[model samples]
Target: MTISWLYIGIFLVVSLGLPAVAIILAGILAPKKPSPEKSIIYECGVDTHGETWVQFKAQYYLIGLVFLIFDIETVFLYPWAVAFDRLGLFAVLEGLLFIGILTGGLVYAWKKGAFEWA
Candidate 1:
C-alpha cells in the first residue's frame, strides 16, 4: 500500500515539478530580445494590409453552422454504414431519420437566406 503511494507521490512530483523546472530553465536561457518585426501578427508569411477585425455578415456564421451540422451527420452515417449489416433495419431507419433532420435543417437555412453569401 505504501509502495503504491510512493509511486503516486513520485508521479505527482514529476508532473507538477517538470513544468516549473522547464519554465525556470527557459526563463534563464531563452533570448531576451523584442524586435518590432517579431511582434507583428503572422498570416502565412503575407503582410497584413488592413484592419484585423472586419465586418462580417451573420449569414456567414449561419452557413458555417449548417456545414458543421451536415459534416457531423456524415460522420455518424459512415460508422453506421460500417456496422450496418449487424444492426439490420433498425440502424438503417435511425440513420435515415438523422439524415432527414439534417436535410430539414439545411432547407430551413436556405429559406432563411443563410446561403446568400452576400
Candidate 2:
C-alpha cells in the first residue's frame, strides 16, 4: 500500500518537476530583446494595417459549437451501434435516451436561430 503511494508520489513529482525546470531554464537562457516591432501585432508574417480588435459574428461561434457537440456524439454512438446485438434492451433504451437528449438540444438551438447565417 505504502509502496503504491510512493510510486504515485514519485510519478507526480517528476511530471510536475520536469515542466517547472524547463520553464525556469528557458527564462534564464532565452534572449531578452525588446523592441517596438516585436511588440506590434503580427498576422501570418504580414504587418496588421488596421484595427486588430474586430468583433466577429456570435452566430459563427454558436454554429461551430453546435457542430462540435454533434460531432462528438458520433464518438459515443459508434461503439454502441457496433455492439448493439450484445447490448440488449437496456442498452438500446439508454442509447435512445442519449439521442433524445441530443435531439432536444438540437431543437432548442434551432428555435434560437443558431443555424442562421445572418
Candidate 3:
C-alpha cells in the first residue's frame, strides 16, 4: 500500500516538479528584448528573401510518397528472405504477393506521371 504511494509520489516529483523548476529558472534568468534586426528571419546568417510559402506541384509529393511506400515495403522482404529456408513455400508466396502489390503501385504511379522529371 505504502510502496505504491511512494512510487506515485516519485513519479509526480520527477515528471512534474523537475520540469516546473527548470522552466521557472530559465524564464527568470533569460533575457527579454526584441529588436528589428533580431525580429527578422535569419537563415545561415543571411537575410531571408521572398515569401516562405511557395507553390509546389502535386507530382513531387506523389513521387516522394510512392518512393516511401515502396522503400518501407521492400525492407519487410529482407526479414522474409532470411527466414525463407525455415518457412519454405509459404514465405515465397507471401513475398511474391507483397512484391506484386508494390509493383502494381509502381505501375499506377508511373502511369500517373509520378516518375517524370519535368
Candidate 4:
C-alpha cells in the first residue's frame, strides 16, 4: 500500500513537473523582442480602435453557462450509456435522477428567459 502511494506521488510529480519544465524551457528559448505592432491589440486580424474593455450582455454569459451545463451532462451520460447493460436497477434510477435534475435546471433557465435571443 505504501509503495502504491509512492508510485502515485511520483506519477503526480512527473505529470506536473513536465508541463512546468516545458513552459520554463519555452520562456528561456523564446525571443525577447517587442515592438509597437506586437503591443497593439488585434482582433480577428483587424486592428482594434476605441475602448478595449467593452461591457458584454449578461444574457450571453447566461446562455454560455446553460450550454456548458448541458455539454458536461453529455460527458457524464456517455459512460453510463456505454455500461448500461451491466448496471443494476439502482444505477438506472440514479441516472434518471441525474437527468431529472438537469432537466429541472433547464426548465428553470427557460422560465428565467435564458433562452431568449434578444
Candidate 5:
C-alpha cells in the first residue's frame, strides 16, 4: 500500500512539475519583445473593427451540448449492439433503459426550445 501511494505521489509530482518547469523555462528563455502590432488582435490578417469580446447566445452552447450527449450515446450503444447476441435479455433491457433516459432528455430539451434556430 505504501509503495502504491509512493508511486502515485511520484506520478502526480512529475506530471505537474513537468508542465510547470516547461512554462518557467519558456518564460526565462523567450525573447522580451513587445510592439503595437503584436498587442493588437489580428483576425484573418485584417484589423478588427468592432469589440473583440462578443457575447454568444446560450442556445448555441446548449445545442452543442445536446449534440455531444447524443454523439456519445452512439459510442456506448455500438459496442452493446455488436455483442448483443452474447449479452442476452439483461443487456437488451439495460440498453433500452439508457435509450429511454436519453430520449426523455431530448424531449425535455425540445420542449425548452433548445432546437430553435432564432
Candidate 6:
C-alpha cells in the first residue's frame, strides 16, 4: 500500500511540476517586445469596427447550450447503443429514463420560448 501511495505521490509531483516549470521557462525565455499594435486587439486580420463589447441576445446562448446538451447526449448514448445487445432490460429502462429527463427539459425550454428566434 505504501508503494502504491509512493507511485501516486511521484505521479502527482511530476504532473504538477512539469507544467509549472514549462510556464516559468516560457516567461523567462519568451520575447519581451511590446508595441502599440501588439497591445491593440487584433482578430481575423481585420481592424475592429464599432463597439467590440456589444451585448448579444440571450436566446443565442440558449440555442447554443441546448444544441451542446443534445450533442453530448448523443456522445453518451452512442456507446450504450453499440453495446445494447449485451445489456439487460434494466439497462434499457435506465437509458430510457435518462432520455425522458432530457426530453422533458427540452419541452420545458420550448414552452418557455427558449427556442424562439426573436
Give lDDT tens digits, candidate 3, residues 1-118. Answer: 9999999999988999888999999999999798988888777688777877879888778878987998899898899878888986876887899899989998998888788978
For model 3, the superposed segments whose C-alpha errors exceed 4 Å read 1-49
RMSD of each: 7.6, 5.8, 7.2, 5.2, 5.7, 6.0
Clash total of candidate 5:
0
**Which scores better on TM-score, 5 or 6?**
5
Which pairs clash in model 6?
Answer: none
Please, what is the TM-score per model?
0.52, 0.52, 0.53, 0.53, 0.54, 0.53
Say which candidate scores most in lDDT. Answer: 4
lDDT of 2 by residue, 1-118 (tens): 9999999999999999999999999999999898998987668788777777899889888988999999999689999999988998988999999999999999999998888777
Per-residue error (Å), model 2, residue 68: 2.0
lDDT of 1 by residue, 47-86 (tens): 8898879898887688778889889779878878888778
Worst 10 residues of 6 by lDDT: 39-48
Q: Candidate 4's residue-wise lDDT over 1-118, tens digit each?
A: 9999999999999999999999999999999999988987667788767886889889889988999999999699999999999999999999999999999999999998998878
Per-residue lDDT over 31-110 for candidate 5, one digit per residue giving the tens place of the 0 to 100 score: 98999879876687887777778998988899889999999886999989899899879879999999999999899999
Model 1, position 13: C-alpha lDDT score: 99
Can you give the lDDT of residue 8 in candidate 3?
98
TM-score of predicted structure 6: 0.53
Please report how far candidate 2 places residue 100 from its true position, in Å: 0.9
Pairs clashing within candidate 1? none
